[model samples]
Target: MPCAAARACPSFLDKSIHPHVLRHSCAMSLLQAGIDTTVIALWLGHAGVRSTDAYVHADMTIKEKALALNTPVTAQPGHYQPTDKALAFLDRL
Candidate 1:
């Protein structure tokens, strides 16, 4: 049966991809593009957000990028030295 299906869809056989694998790849692609998990779940016809969480958990690239984005600004360089006038205002306060 699988062989017949593969013959019917040559691209699938050429890529050696299964339908569920393709769906997972598509879902992961969408997640990497910053689309919300809720939207991904709906797009993939998942019953709940939990179903989509597996894709996110399995993709370290997306997780790494998201973690980088959430990193505190203080971790970066450049001290916040105020101008003379600004310092004076702070002193007044």
Candidate 2:
């Protein structure tokens, strides 16, 4: 009952892979390729996109990329201009 792929591939010979592993692979591939989680959820038959969050949180590269785009808070504090236009409107009140 073993699939040919499992036989020919030495890496898969000793280990057991669940059907969900394929689902996980497909989801992770889509995620790394910049596909949205909504699409991945639909592919996996997940009722909610929130279920795909596990993959998002599981991938550390995504976290690393997010950290790379962040500006460190180590810079000396300086006066910052308030960007909230609502403040200006409130001030005029």
Give the distance in Å from residue 42's predicted Cα in candidate 1 to where it truly belongs: 0.7
Q: Per-residue CA lDDT of candidate 2, range 1-93, in tens?
A: 667987788678788889979889989999988888899899888999999999999998887677666747785444456767978888999
In model 2, how large is the Cα lDDT of residue 58? 92
Clashing pairs for model 2 are none
Provide the overall lDDT of each model, using Cα atoms, as 2-decimal numbers. Answer: 0.85, 0.84
Model 2 residue 53 lDDT?
99
Clash count of each predicted structure: 0, 0
Top TM-score: which candidate number?
2
Please provide, for model 1 over 38-89, each residue's C-alpha lDDT reduced to its tens digit, 9 standing for 90 to 100.
Answer: 9999998999999998988999998678777787986764445789999999
lDDT of 1: 0.85
